[model samples]
Target: MKKVLFSAALFFTACAVSAQESVVKEAKSAKSDPVKAAQIIEPALTDPSTANDPETWKLAGDFQKSIYDDENMKLYLPGGQADTAKLYNSLAKMFEYYTKCDEVEQAKVQSGELKKPKLRKKLAKTLATVRPQLTNAGSDAYNAGNYANALKFFGLYVDAPQNPLFADEDAVKNDTLTPLIANYAALAANSLKDNAAVIKYATIGKEHKEEGYRSLMCLAEAYGKGETPDSAKWLTTIQEGVEKFPSQEYFIGNLMDYYIQKGKIDEGLAQMDAVLAKNSTPYFMYVKGVLQYEKKDYEGAIATFNQIIAEGKDFVAEAYSKIGDCSFFPAQEIVEENSKLSMDDPKYATNEAKIKELYEKALPFYEKAKEAKPDNRQLWGQYLLNIYWKLDKEKYNALEKELGY
Candidate 1:
């Protein structure tokens, strides 16, 4: 018992320390020893096995963060390390790369190497210049509080590095601007999940998920932002963005989630109709299940999510986790709100009975999620803890002992 208590205490202490230490790690790495920095970076850049190690990734992240934060280091990748013409000229080359990919993809379709998607050759060609166009347009939208427009424009800026879209215009006024602009755009977009601007940027990132790690941040933000938007415009904007950027799973998931949160079942279902037009992805299906869950169509949601868990073998764990999360709170909330009366009082019993039904329905989903994500012990433990919360201490103690929590 003492050992277990000590272990739990130590774990909590470690988590707290990690959180506080993260901020300082960035500051310290700025002036790290050259040999040690190089040693860390070598493994990070080349060793796949060591790729996810925090120490290595953080060292590189800190180095880049410091350079970006440094006013002097905010210069060029396209051309000008310092000069104006060189900087924008380098931007032109990035546009040239966008043009290259666009041309290659378009030509592949025309030459029979790829299927002609709905937004094919013409769309691809237009996107070639999209990056450069957004560089100027997104800043305009951002300053005006039209994050929707800014997000859209920023999406264009992703393919071509020279055209940084998400930063303050003043930042772009310098010769060394791309990294600063890129980082800032990423930051700004991340800060506004429901802002249409975030949806737009994430959509672009979704397509180029392979090359742009920056997109991943925007994708997560877009999903988070759209969950409870302030306006209907945000909903429509995100919906449209998802339709347009099917490959951008981040935006699509966020938009669909918004549909669920707003209690717009029909609208969410309609959006799924849109999702079906393109190659269907987990992001799309996940939204559909969540929408049903929000509507209290538990069976429908569970069945749909079950199909996803089965079909998406690689994503089954995440799929179950989502189902668990989607059902847990909603059922709990309903049960809690209804648990006001005694079981014998007809009025009180009505709500209490409903509460039991909700919990009964919800438990299996959470348990299934736990089973699917066995490695995610913390999440599984939390689910068990919650279940125990609804039960007697004797039962809770028994389960806790069984799980060693």
Candidate 2:
């Protein structure tokens, strides 16, 4: 019985070695026949006899890398259309196999089962050459609306710099594409509604030059809507965005909307006041005025708009329109209220005169706004129409005709 068992053990050992050698031979054919090579090497990865062997994993990695190279080469051929799914999949598999190989090899080195590192330098060099392709894969996936795959590829690219295989590579450290790719990753995460992922990538991306503003916006949205929302972080991020990207309205609009929704318009005004005190831009002052208007502080809004007008900046026309709005909206409220009152009410005539007086007060400001920016119908057109209809029918008819109304 003991002799029979020994013979059986020897036979299995021979079979294992033969299988390992066969897989390696198949891997060599990967350059010309990668699909068949994959069929053989893929199963060898999990087979009990070859699973722990670093050589098997290395062959697998090399096979996938060869497949990627061949597929990428086809892109330069005449009328060659890339199979993006195949290309991305092969790249991802190459990374995975190489990572597994490295892990196994390192373990063997530590265990003294291997005399020295065999594939580490070759793996590092190959990965350094292949790392940048991750960005292209991510972009293709993103444009194709494959958010999950896009995030995967982008995340791998972002992580490649710190990966052990690229430890000696300066190219990863100096790559200018990192920040842009980070922003794209955040955008992909946002499309997937993966708030945590958005925050993760956007935090890194917010320093990019061209896409930083967009990343900052993504960061704020993630903070506001994450599983356990952090309102303070959301507010701070939006404030930072407003300061960094003053020309973009997204941050400021969302900030104001948050305050309005929370019924904290006064708080919003206070914050804008603090910003204005520090940097006193016409844009921030306009935001403050709008917040004051939302709070129904008409007098405060008019004063803020007047200050913006005094500054004589690009906001002058908007300031004039806002000043007109303050009076015009109040007059509209009076009209609504007067309609509810009985015609015989003694206050009815007084309310009608007050409405007309407010309209008269608004007319000059709207006219000034129109004069300042004749092409900006949004600033003054409807307001002027309302004022003329109430205070002067002849001008109202003429203006209506000119407007094609």
Candidate 3:
């Protein structure tokens, strides 16, 4: 009877041990299965972020990574919630683990989800909703010295209807986003060297009062910068803008530049004269002087620049430098070239008188400018160089002795 009891006990122990081993194997298998592992690890995601329910929590973590990355991320990270400060913090930590700064991290900060679909429809849609703000942000970016970011925002402003930020913009019956957007669009286009875009945006800007003037600037800058070869087109745009906003000095100045570049010297001069007639800002006069210098009207340029210097408060050393440039480039020599005698001959004495007269006209302006701008190396050098070359031997020798130069 005792031996029978022992056998029964052995059978019971072996059965128990076998059941325990089977349980352990099953647990290992469950842990190895990713889907099951995820479910077992964080079932809250599977039950909540999915599509079957109004609450988007069910598929929150179950998107097919290869196929639905964008979709999943969008679902989890919806637009308004995408780039929150808290969400960004979380994303930053995850990226720090890998020592990388992938756009995915930014998107995660943007969308607030790891399971976001690769296509990112939600973010795009959200972006469309904030179109106006984004456009404004683009302008701000340019103001803040971020050209690339400015271009991006301006692009969104133009294409706002298709973007996620579209709803945030303002549209009117008589005046819509088309014009305002085009203004910013021109600025962006100029920065990016997109000539077509500049034309499109500047046209829109011209529809508005303040922004229109700015748009004209974009047109002028684009042509001046040589990013676009369509100078004629830019000029035409400037003329139209000038006609519409006639009193705007900024637009007039740009128009002057356009005419000069187009080689319409008389028209450019007329424009400058009109501008100067109104109130000769040093800059306008300086530009006029430069135009004269380039056109080989050295005497005319010198006279205009002198008017600026005499005005005292309107101009800077640039005017002085430019005047020196014109005189130093042999304006007197050129007149001598047309004379009837060699410089060393008796007839040349007549030529020398003309040279001295021209030199006298330029000397005091440079000398006075140099004195006023003691720290300006360019002005000082110009004065010294001119003095040494233009004055007679006795006068030059005396001045050099005085200056100890």
Candidate 4:
């Protein structure tokens, strides 16, 4: 009876060994059929009895990664191409498995249970190659207007710490592509109107030397678009951007607008003054003139604008127009207040004389502005006609005929 029991146990043990052998053989033979191989090894990867086996994890990784092979990817992935969103999940899964394989193998190597010189090198190559795949996926998603997925893919590339190629220096030093990736992510987030995401990604790019200026602008714009934006934060970002990117008119212009919006024209003037004190650039001087105009300092604005014209800068036309505007404002204020007054009043002649004097001051600047920028004839044409009507009806009628007014 004992022998009979032993025979039965032996038969069962043999059957179990044959079944394990069959599975291993099938796993190896199904290399071209990664789907089949994956099915064979998945159980071993999860089974507690074999879960700790590094070889099982490595097999799982290999099978998953094989799904991205040039031929296999086209056949198995969506879009029937290597560079489609359909391959994103597959590529992501490959990265995950390979990371696990590397981790388990490295642990075994540390414990003196494995020797993986060739495998470690291979894993490094694979991780580096995965980076471009992620980038391609991101580009594909971006071109498709899948901004959320574009951001996700780019973020994955930027934050992928499991990559052996980046494992050493990624934590301590910034990657050369890090800023560009963050910038792209910010662009994607911005397209989606994800203000928070724009702030987050652009902040990363803002620290980079090459992309910092663009990132700062993006961040500032994002802050301005926020539901409950912090004006101080927006102001700070624009100021910083202007300081760092002095050549970028967008930042300086944005900074000026912020001050104007806050009713701090004096502060804007002081800021422009400080910038001019360092380097009296034509643009800066022009901006100072604008701030003066906003402050209703017509004389100061005219003086500053004259200085801009003297600089022989490209903005001379704009300066001339702004100077004309400065002269017009006071006369406009007087007309608005006293237009209702009867000509019989004693004050009428005095007011008319004052208005004429102001129009005279504006006339030459408007004429020069038109001469300098004939392409913008329409810009100051109405003002010119109005001034002419007040002081010279003949010129007004001529200009009205020319402008079809």
Candidate 5:
């Protein structure tokens, strides 16, 4: 029985030695036939003695990564697709194998089995070359309409340690590509409707110095769409975007709509007032006018609109339009009051005169707006028809004919 057991142990040892030698030979020749090479070496990754062997891990990693590198070459061969999914899978495996190699190498160094600084530096150099490849894969996936896969690739590129292409893990600042990657990842998550991932990446991306406002917008959108929507967080993000990118009406406009929908016009006005106090830019001035108009502070709106005109801003037409809108409200009020009274009532004539005066006051601003924005003929025609009805019936009839009314 003892002799049989010894023979079995010898047989097993010989088989292990043969397997190791095959793996080494495969690794050496993998460049020419990487698929067959990988098939031979992958089992060693889980084998007890080889699993912790740095050389085994390194060989597997280098061989698989070479396979991944050659994938694009296959597309030039006859009857071959790029097979991006397969390429991405190979890259994923490469990263895993490289990471395992790193772990084993570090363990070997700690155990005094290897002297390491040189080996670690070489591994870092290898990782640096691989980093941008992952980013390229992400962009390719995104262009191919594979957003989830794009997210996976970008996430790996940005999160990998010692990537050299991105900023440190503590923050992704200073690196332009870092924000770009985060933006792409966030957009991918948005396309997938993965609200949580959108919030995650977008929130981080919002710290980007040059393009943070875009990320803030994404975060706001994500918050509204996420499960159990957080309106407060959404509002805060929108406000931040408005403050950071005051010239960008997209954020301000979204905030305005949010306030209007929630019946918080006064709150919106207060927020705009704060923004106006800080910068008083032409855009913010225009926003202040809009907010005041929504709050029915017509006189304040007209004054703010005038300030935009004084600044010689491009929003002059819009300002004139708002000023005309201010006069419209008072004119409407006079007409409404007059409608409640009989024509013979003593105050009826007085109200009619007041209404005509207000309409006349509004008409010039509307005409100026029309001159500034001639393409807005429909808006001008509507306002002119109202003014002509209050003052000149002949002109009203002629204008109505020209307007196809």
Candidate 6:
């Protein structure tokens, strides 16, 4: 009875080994038919006898790559139409399988199951060759408004340089498109409202030259959002953005808006004062003037703007316009005060004269603003119309005709 039981155990063990070898051989023979080969070998991945074999995972990777290639090749055929969705799906699967194969091989090497990696070079070469396609796939999905998939593909491409498959490749290290792809991934994350992902990618994206400003803007926006917004980080990010890109108004404007929204004008002015102490640029002076204006310290604003004008920088026109606003807003307040009194009131005429005096003060500055930026209607057009109407009707009518009003 003992001998018979031992024979049965031997038969079962032999059958398991035979099943593993038989499936492997049959899968290899059907390699030309990628679909059939994949179907035949699918079970081997989880089969107790073959699950630990690196060769099984490698075969699976090859089948997936073959499926991707077969579908992609249809694009060159005369009447063959390729399904892009299927192509990208297979391509992603190919990458996954290849990554898994590499992991399994490494694990085997570590476990003393193999002397060295035999497939590393081949796998690395294959991954390098196909890496750029991930960018193309991401861009296509982005243009199609598939933000989630676009982020996925772009993330894969962005991370490929650091991937183990490209550990020895210098070309991957110097790839210039990584930063740009990171920008795209950040844009996708922004579209998806994934603030964490936006910060993640935008931090990397902001290192790119041509598109770096946009990434910086996105980073600031992400830092300023969410349930518990980091106001300090948001301000710091905007300040850094302004320092790096002084010509970009978005960063400066956001910085100023934050001060206004949080009623921290004094804090903003102190910081600006500190900045100006080191190197006073006309642009920084203009920001200071605008902050003062928002704080309703019109005299201080006018003084700051006058300093900008004295510097004879490109901000001269903006300085003149802001000065006009200082006088104009005061005149408007006088007009409101006069409206509250009766025409026979003693202070009415006095207030009226003061209003005219302020309008007269504003006239020259508005004229200068118009001369500096003739095409910029926002700077001077409407303000000049009001000033001229109050003080000179004929000039107002003529200017109105010229503006096609």
Winner on TM-score between 1 and 3 is 3
Q: Record all residue pairs in model 4 with backbone atoms less than 3 Å apart, i.e. clashing.
A: none
lDDT score at residue 155, model 6, on the 0-100 scale? 87
**Runs with alpha carbons beyond 4 Å of true place in candidate 1:** 1-240, 312-315, 318-338, 343-362, 375-383, 386-395, 398-405
Every model's TM-score: 0.42, 0.75, 0.53, 0.72, 0.69, 0.69
Write one digit per residue (lDDT tens) for candidate 4, span 233-350.
Answer: 8888998887877777788788898788789998888778777776667888888888888988888988998888988877899899999898787898878757888888878788
Candidate 3 regions with alpha-carbon error over 4 angstroms? 1-129, 136-149, 160-181, 221-228, 241-264, 276-280, 286-307, 316-331, 334-344, 374-380, 390-405
Q: Sort all candidates by lDDT, best to worst.
A: 2, 6, 5, 4, 3, 1
Kindly list the per-residue Cα lDDT of model 5 for residues 1-405, writing each as its tens digit. 999999999999889977876766665776578777888887777776678777787788777777777885786789877777777778877777776777777777778888862345565556656667788888888999998889888877656644432223333333357766777788888888888888877876777777777678778878887778898998888888887877677887888888877879898888888777776777778877888898888888999899888888668888998898888778888889988999999999999888888898899888888888878775477887889987899989997897788
Pairs in clash, predicted candidate 5: none
Scored by lDDT, model 6 comes in at: 0.85
lDDT by residue for model 3 (115-191), tens? 54332343333333333455555666678777666665565455544333223333412326656766777877787
lDDT value, residue 145 of candidate 5:
97
lDDT by residue for model 2 (1-405), tens: 999999999999999878877776766666468777877777678776676888888878877887788888889999887776788898998888887888888888899999887888788788878888898899888889999999999988887776776666788767788888899999999999899889888988898877888789888878887788899999899988877876666887788888889999988887676666677778878888899988888898999999999889869999999999999999999999998999899899899899999999999999999999989989999988988998899999988887889
Winner on TM-score (1 vs 4): 4
lDDT of 6 by residue, 203-259 (tens): 888888778777788887788886678888888889988777766768867877778
| Per-residue lDDT value at 355 in model 4 | 85
Cα lDDT of candidate 5 equals 0.78
lDDT of each: 0.54, 0.86, 0.57, 0.77, 0.78, 0.85
Error of 1 at 95 (Å): 18
How does model 1 score by TM-score? 0.42
Q: Is candidate 5 or candidate 6 better by lDDT?
A: 6
CA lDDT for candidate 1: 0.54
